[model samples]
Target: MPISSHLSQSPEGDTFVKIRFLAACTALAAATALTGCSQLAGSADGPQKVTLWLMKGSASEDFITKFTSSFEQEHPDIDLEIKIQEWTGIGEKVNAVLAGKSKESADVIEVGNTQVAQYIETGGLSEVTLEGLRVWGSKDWLKGLSDPGSINGAQYGVPWYAANRVVIYNKDLFDDAGVKPGPKTRQEWISATQKLDKGSQQGIYLAGQNWYVLAGFIWDEGGELAVETGGQWVGTLGDDKGLAGMEFYKQLQALGDGPKDADEETPPQAQVFARGQVAQIIGTPSQAAEIEAANPALKGKLGFFPIPGKTAEKPGAVFTGGSDLIIPDKTPHRARAVEVITALISEKWQTELARTMSYVPNKTTLAHLVEGNDGAATMAVGAAQGRATPPTGRWAELEGKNPIKPYMTAVLTGQDPKQAAKTASDTISKVLSSDR
Candidate 1:
């Protein structure tokens, strides 16, 4: 946390945010109509009201309903005020809250696990000791999964849940391609995709602008976005391994059809797939539910498979997309907030989360609950091999702005991969250095 009692916010700051919110309201509402605010009431004078800010999920209401009742039974003196927020513009809203723009403080909050490092470095989250978290068994978090919340040697967030991408393809398309149930290697995957590409129907939808998706290829080639050395950030995009990864990414670009310039959000990969024209997509389990919601007929036709890395022996490293639970330093109820986080990562809650939400639980041992299902089984393998960006606040800027998108576009549109890599490395270097 910052040394100051609180980060002061001028009235103008709130007004500025309001203006931004108003400008984006129409867009926000469209993407987040399913989201709304809610709260849990407690006795006026008895227990401290600990506010919680969590992003809305499919089973959010159920999880909150059950957890709130159980939590109150366990800690009678601490009442929870659950406030659900939308993922759209959540980072900025959280930034405003941490900067003290509003008087209504959230005692406990859920932050994107990748974004957690930015908050930790910014003093937006309270420092938590691993021993303190271990009392509740949070120390049993999945291998590399928990590292997103850990910096240097200190912990800042508790692993809540993860949603990693797995290949969900149309079984009918696979049959037409004369392919097996799933790919055993990178070569086989490409061959299968090419075979699946027929008249009017495409093989895949690779969102070129999605760096999260792009990073998987980079990681598979033993490359990374950036690396810190001698207390300085360095971009690795121009390196040999990075070149190899981008070349591999370009190879797939030839086997797919979509707005090559567009992202996963603009023409949502799932919504596009729901049309039944695309054969497969690398998406999270949430998209499986979304496919059903958008076009029910496509539900039974989908098959789940883990993304293989270079060879059948190695599973590809997918982006682990999810949130972590953290307490703010300015919150009045620190211990109570700890209790809330503790309850969230508890064995019972972890199991319930997996059973209801399709999220891979934080603990590796609890992954058995997810593996029974095909997509969850594939994601279980990914969670173990998953990788996160370097632990630095500047990383948030890189993701938020996505400087690599244009470079990826350049490569996909005919520029030499090496030339694009050099340009991307230059831009990344400048971005990282400017932050310092």
Candidate 2:
């Protein structure tokens, strides 16, 4: 049976409407469908078809199609067909397919950064030995980009690209408030925020429920989410460093520097920043473009900087986001897939993708390929130098249960920072300890 046949049917909800809504915002869903189908590349005597599962969206689809077209031209024998699923629905769809006996339909797949660890833990990923890494020469891969896909020294997924967050500040607001151009330390960040806080405009625009952003501060303060003490995943959010980070967020919130309630679905931090309702914002590189498009008047007035750390020597933590390509455990075209992956990560392809998508390429050598594109290069370099968040099997579950953003929201909304941190830590510990 085809993998789609085995999986549960889509819910009766207004799928088309939802997809249209997402498409209007970013063309992400449209890209997924167009690229989900594959086209054969190599000689006609070789394998005729290769099936791939990818997230829905036009950008993803376009990327896949463009890359596949190039790969096909180089090797015309292989034909590729793509299956697209919404980003929000991909996990459940993949899980259902993998749980069933029909694994043949899924040959190549794309997994999100956070979803990768969980999928690996569930044996959803095929094991790729260190020797397999040799196919895609080591020199071409970025260290940080590949680290997330490895578990206990074995590689499972090859990084497609990386997206790191940076602080985007409104220079006009800074100038008006007499704040400095950039913040070099945590203290400087705080002072700048205070100075920028006007009655109608906030000094800082934060999404109250975004734990990923919150984690950067915790990490900047030299804190870990779970410390591996004697081979145990122990909670660390209640520790001194974690508390300090939480308190910083709380102070900002107390001063009306952030939203009282914000979430992945509803918070409009980027929009707020673009409209001059906020002076500073921490967001992905794409956000700069969004801001420029939203408020053209703010073009030269926008300034970019890396998130501030505890000190100059310690770089602030950035939550890395992006897609990665993975071959399923029971794929019939393993060799062909490997060949394709190797080509995709090549310096040539990496450079092209980086240029078109504004994604950070996975190859260190390709870093220079983005020479004039300083923004993307900076994010890529920071990711290479910074530490990644804890990679655990239950990360998604933990995140869902604890919802770090809400805890930060509570703290910012005048709840006890220590208590909120303790509650969040306990919830995360429970989630992590439950399964793998």
Candidate 3:
């Protein structure tokens, strides 16, 4: 999705993605039928047909049509087939295609950045490290998107566009509290929030189970949710740095009236902020629209800044959430597929995509293209320091009934932070280690 697009911090975002995915299936099928299906591999003396599976809404129909025309003009020997897929059952769909179990297969597939690990585990994605380094300057790619696509030292998924969280504030509330807009460091941010938390006006609207925000803080303190030790994944939230991060979270949460046992989606934090009593909230810049719709009076009253870090040097590390492009290992048009992907991620196309969609570019160097947009510009400041969740297939399972949420709730409600973290860490270890 575009950096300007909104995806919830809770499971509701997953639901939204699924709906967009399923809804496009029929539309795409009708288009393919009208155009007629192209041969998968075709003949050696004939033009090669390269199939691409992209998620619905990833790009506009106009963008796709333009790219297809230009790419075909550039390479007359190869024909491109673009298929729009849905997020709903994409994992199973990708697996079936990679395993050669599905009748429809794609040479290149667009998957979530965090999902690369699971697909790599299936032994179906081709390694593209050399191409990423020599042709694309892989070193310049955003850490959040690049790191997850790499396992051990081999790269499976290529970095695409990215989106992360930022501090979205109500300008009127800040002005009334006599506080400034940007806080350079974490301490400065906390101090400013303290001044903003007057009666009936919360400093921030941060729910207790907003673990995505917590992930950034923990990373700022040099902690990991789980780490690999001697060939096994172990949870480390009970570590000293982890607890220190939680302590900071506790301090910040006290400045607001957000629920201790609920997440941002329970009552929808955007709606709460729209009520006009909150000063700030940690969310994607796209939520500003939701807030505006709930109360149109606040349309121009919103502003955004990168999430502050411990020091003034850079923003805190956030969980880089976005999509990645990968190639199935079994594709017959491997060489041609590489050519197509290289074109899409090149500087020319990357800039076009970012500018057209208001997305953070794959490489931080290209971030300047979207500098005119407030939200994309703010998100790019922290894109270099972005991190993804544990690169394990089982990680998605943890999202459902996440142990970290209860641990956060317990610590916020006055339980012993150490004991609560220990319980959560133990569950994380067991879950990551399980096969079924």
Model 2 TM-score, all chains together? 0.80
For model 1, the superposed segments whose C-alpha errors exceed 4 Å read 1-45, 92-101, 136-139, 143-145
What ordering of candidates by lDDT runs from best to worst?
A: 3, 1, 2
Name model 3 segments beyond 4 Å from true.
Answer: 1-45
* Model 3 steric clash total: 0
lDDT of 2 by residue, 1-436 (tens): 1111100012223112101000111222322232232321233354456666655441344566667666665654456655665566667666655554553366777677556676787775676554244455554565545666777888786777777777778877888888887677888888878878879888877757766666777877778878755555767888999988777766655544555687532555667677777787766656777788888987877777777777877557776666667877767555555555666677787778788777777766667766677567666655654445567777766655665766777777678877877887777777777754
For residues 184-276, what per-residue lDDT tens digits would candidate 3 score against the true structure? 899999999999998989999899998988988999999999998876789999999999899999999999999999988878899999999
- Could you tell me which 10 consecutive residues in candidate 3 have the lowest summed lDDT? 15-24
Reference-based TM-score, model 3: 0.89
lDDT of each: 0.70, 0.64, 0.81
Stronger candidate by TM-score (2 vs 3)? 3
Show model 2 residue runs off by greater than 4 Å. 1-47, 58-65, 96-100, 137-145, 178-180, 228-232, 252-256, 385-389
CA error at residue 204 for candidate 3, angstroms: 0.3
**Model 2 residue 57 distance off true place after TM-score fit, in angstroms:** 3.5
